[model samples]
Target chain A: MPTDHIMKTYDDELKRLNNAIIRMGGLAESQVAASIQATVKRDSELAHEVVEQDAQVDALEAEVEALAMRLLALRQPMARDLREIVSSLKIASDLERICDYAANVAKRSIALNQAPVAKPVYAIPRMGKLAQALIKDVLDAYVQGDADKAMHVWLSDEELDELYTSLFRELLTYMMEDPRSITAGTHLLFMAKNIERIGDHATNIAETIYYLIHGTPLKEARPKRDRSSTSVVLPGPVAVATTDSEETK
Target chain B: MPTDHIMKTYDDELKRLNNAIIRMGGLAESQVAASIQATVKRDSELAHEVVEQDAQVDALEAEVEALAMRLLALRQPMARDLREIVSSLKIASDLERICDYAANVAKRSIALNQAPVAKPVYAIPRMGKLAQALIKDVLDAYVQGDADKAMHVWLSDEELDELYTSLFRELLTYMMEDPRSITAGTHLLFMAKNIERIGDHATNIAETIYYLIHGTPLKEARPKRDRSSTSVVLPGPVAVATTDSEETK
Candidate 1:
């Protein structure tokens, strides 16, 4: 075959991979949306659908990997082609994880339905909406190769983080106030965490998009705002707490 | 250059990539170990060291990625060589995440030192040791191409998951019994969760090694035993709770 013919065929294969990524992203976004709906509505059926649908995302990721490996071996993609192909693998993995977290949230929603739903459970959908938007924007950024849009998604994740921290405190305080609510509150905490992690994966995809477009890593430190890792909520009427102490210094 | 001479240089380059992965694995293992030590001893300095050392793991992962991409483009490796190179990208990414989780554990440890230590904090080091061993064994499996050894690491992760679930219950129960311990218990919960995630990444590396050596994906459902997400521990004198409800059914 002529080199021109081979090159054109390789370009087509790359396009196929790109389309597969977009499809995978669509599945992930719906999974996140449906999972959050399941939690808020206490719809076990929708949650079950989300959990079962994760297999499709995993299968798509496997397909992307096989196609990528074949392209690397046969076409020997270099420079821009190589970066795009490599970024696809990383991006697919991140999407797979985002779907996994969505499924996890769905799983916890089923558990949450066992007890009286806590008041804070409503906050899950609000956070979920933000995460879903980030996934959508990041996927758009990925498909269009828009670094600025991807950067916007990256910066927007701080809001989700802030929301998660407030929810974390609320759930703990709720659990303490009504010991019976502890069961539901714990599940909600994990569900919220799953959504927060989905946001993080969106940020990761943004970084991958930035790298793919610029051929260089985004150099600025990420604007991370999740302080829940060190957060402490004391159980009392005063409810006063220290976020950190000198021992950490 | 002769084809034979070019093949020799490619072989050397592959060896260099292999060495870098091993070095990256070593750093991740130590980070897990030191981060656990920091938590057990409440040593802020040691925790700080683990946090600082994560950058080396990050740098080494970047080096592996660059080398893998170079080999894929320049060598145009086929069959086993292609699989090995591709697997390095995945394995390095998993190791990098293991280090990130380790750093997270270290960060939580520093925060934990600020408050009264919970009795359940001691379970963290136990879980950490299991996770560290898994990392070491999986690294050896990757380097030696020992699928059986990798499978061992894969199965042993169940034990870590089981341990984490028990710790999750213990911490929640402890917090309920003494409301004053809630702050410390929350930090300990995250630390244990981080260690459990480290174990998960080790399992991920083991799966990559299995595929690399066998040329077939491991089709069996992993013996996953972490039920903490659905776990609901009620607060009462009897301290009894249901793990799940019919809504999941």
Candidate 2:
């Protein structure tokens, strides 16, 4: 094939690969959302669905790996293209692991259903939403190659941590007050912790974006919570860019 | 340079890089161990030592990265060398993150020093030991290029999960029986969870080994725990091959 033809084909392959990863991301994110809903709504069926679908997540990861390997072996991708391809592989693994933690959360939710919750789980649901949103934004950032947006996702981790900490304190109070609260309160804590981990995985993805573009790891990516230069109004979430702020909404 | 000389130089650089990573692993392992000691024994000074040493850990990471980058640019390595170098980058990042978690745990310990712990923290010390052992084994495996040994570290994640679950239950039980246990017990639980995460970082290294060597992803690493065939002696730790089964005296 001609060089132009090959370049065009490689570009197309890269697009397909990114789309496949986003589709996987959608699945992973929904697992987290459904898992939270399973606990909040006491829906064993939804929890079960999350559990059963883990295998599908696993399979998708394998497919992504296979696709990445095929591209690397055939294309001999260089520099930026290499970074983008490698990032996909790493991000897919990270997403798959996120799904596992989400599944674990759902399983714990089901297990805790037998006992009364130690206290109302008001914070966990919000924290879950926040984490899920951060992950969504990170995925959006990646598809659009938006580093700044990815950094925004990175900044969101602290809020999740704070919410998790509050939930931790509340559940501990309930458990301390009544022996019967032990079983369920413990499960809730694990669920919250699992969600916190999901946020960390999203942060990992953002850090990878920094690497893909600059070949330099951001030593500290925690968005300046106090806000100095973080508030850039980039193009709405879909125009792809070679840089980190492209909006792939 | 002749291929032989180039090969010799590349081999030397890779070995040096690997040694640097192992040294970093040793420091991280000590940080976890020392942090736990400080927390459990209320040794504030030891906690400070770990904190003070973290900058050194960060420095080591920077040095290793500079070395790896120089090797990549100078040697223009082939695929296998490329894999080794990339794995070094990732493993260092994971180790650095693990150390950060250890320091965070110690920080929480400092906070908890304001009051006595409600119960003996049996699970945390054990979890730390397990995590340390996993890191030791994975580093050993990677250095030796022993796929089987690496596989065992990968499966060891289940052990961490099981330990975490038991710790959660035990902590919850303490809190249920005593309200004063709430704050201390919750911090302890998060600390234990951090230790468990160290095991996870080791598992990530193991998967990286599989990818670098076999060029395939082990997607079902978690759901199926039967990967003993990849170990050094594992019909039991790796000697049997089960070094982990060695008497914990």
Candidate 3:
């Protein structure tokens, strides 16, 4: 009877830990979606609400961390069980960062409201939608222990990167054409970057999910198309002037 | 005798875990410094070397994760011991990210080398120096389990933020003044942001160290002065024209 009771207690604690992560994930998804809506509509009130809602995500992260630590000490879970608890800690950290990026988008929306519209705000909203979808899909994957769903989310991040790169070039063009647009354009650029980073966090979660189920790190290289600046590999040294025109594009 | 043997084995594993993190921290610090050197000197070979060195950091992270999980499952350490193992995992993750950012700076250096010089690259190197110093100090704090040193590193991130904000404005001015400089200016902006993020990861380490030693979070809000767009708080709707000039400055 005592053995059965201890087993039941362990199962209950595990369920609670999973539920905490689910709640945190839901909060993060809503915060990100609302922040994007606030930016696109220039609704400062909505933006303020997104900023205020971030506190809940932060608190939930703390709760998840505490619970995971307690499980580690008390249960001494082995193999897959250990992976599940540790991965929860990692996912919670990623979710918190996603919430932070959402808050950044909200804050930038306010500053963007103060400036004249630089360009039609189409791409950033698209990127945000993609990022939010990835977050949701990865969380569902976590619940089901579905590595296939997580892999799908991981592969789709390249699309977000492609969108970001094109938007980046367009923003630069706007700023260059009209010096007056620099202020608004810069804020828009940051918003796009924030969404891009959220996409990265989603990828991190997907990778974590894969590790949890498989008991091994994802061995494949992450599909990446972020060719903005950092990923560009150069050939042998050539005259700087010759490459200037090619780079300016 | 059996209990003594088990305790000794546990202590030895903990020492190994600490050593792994210290090694990873040292590698991350060197990578950051080398990438910055590669950027300032426009040395493609050195930049390539930094990129290659990242594999070692990634391997070290995996090793640390494995060791931590082993310790948790085998020892079921209570209280402070549990915190120490979990904190090592978190610190190792942070260190890996810091190394990734350093690799990013190196990648950008190759791209920036192909373009004509945008502005004298003074501020970014200085920012890199500050970030490198923070990484070193936080690692020392981790080794000593000194909460005070960790807190000091946590507070000093504000200086990096101030420098980043000033650098941000200067980059915008350069891009606006000359359309031709946009490509190079954009790359430099990313490098600066990368350094700023390294500072953030350093602060993350500080927080983790504090939690490990003190058994509680650093309850004080992190000191922040990053007033570039995302940190700005908006007042009630004012004349758009009135805010435009202020924003440009």
Residues A47-114 of candidate 2 have per-residue lDDT tens digits of 87887888788788778766766676577676777777778877987898789888877776666565
* Top-scoring candidate (TM-score): 1
The best candidate in terms of lDDT: 1
**Residue pairs with backbone overlap in model 3:** none
- Specify the CAPRI tier of model 3: acceptable
TM-score of each: 0.94, 0.80, 0.91
- The residue-by-residue lDDT of candidate 3 on B1-249, one tens digit each, is 999999999999999999999999999999999999998898989988998888789899999998998898888888999999999999999999999899888877887887766574778789999999999999999888899999999999889988987787777667666656665777777788889889999999999988998898876667676667643222233112212211110
Candidate order, TM-score descending = 1, 3, 2
State the lDDT of candidate 2 residue by residue for B1-249, as single tens digits.
698997887789888998899899899889988988988788877877776788788888887877766665566565677677767877887888789778767766665675575574766778888888888898888878888888999887778766765565556556555556666676676677677778778888888888778765565535332121111211111122211211000
- Candidate 1 vs candidate 2, DockQ winner: 1
lDDT of 3 by residue, A98-160 (tens): 998999888888888876665747777899999999999999999999999999999998898
Candidate 3's error at B134, in angstroms? 0.5
Q: Which regions of candidate 3 are displaced past 4 Å?
A: A230-249, B1-3, B230-249
Candidate 1, which segments miss by more than 4 Å at Cα?
A1-5, A237-249, B1-5, B237-249
How many residue pairs clash in all the candidates, one count each? 0, 19, 0
Q: How much TM-score does chain B earn in each model? A: 0.95, 0.83, 0.91
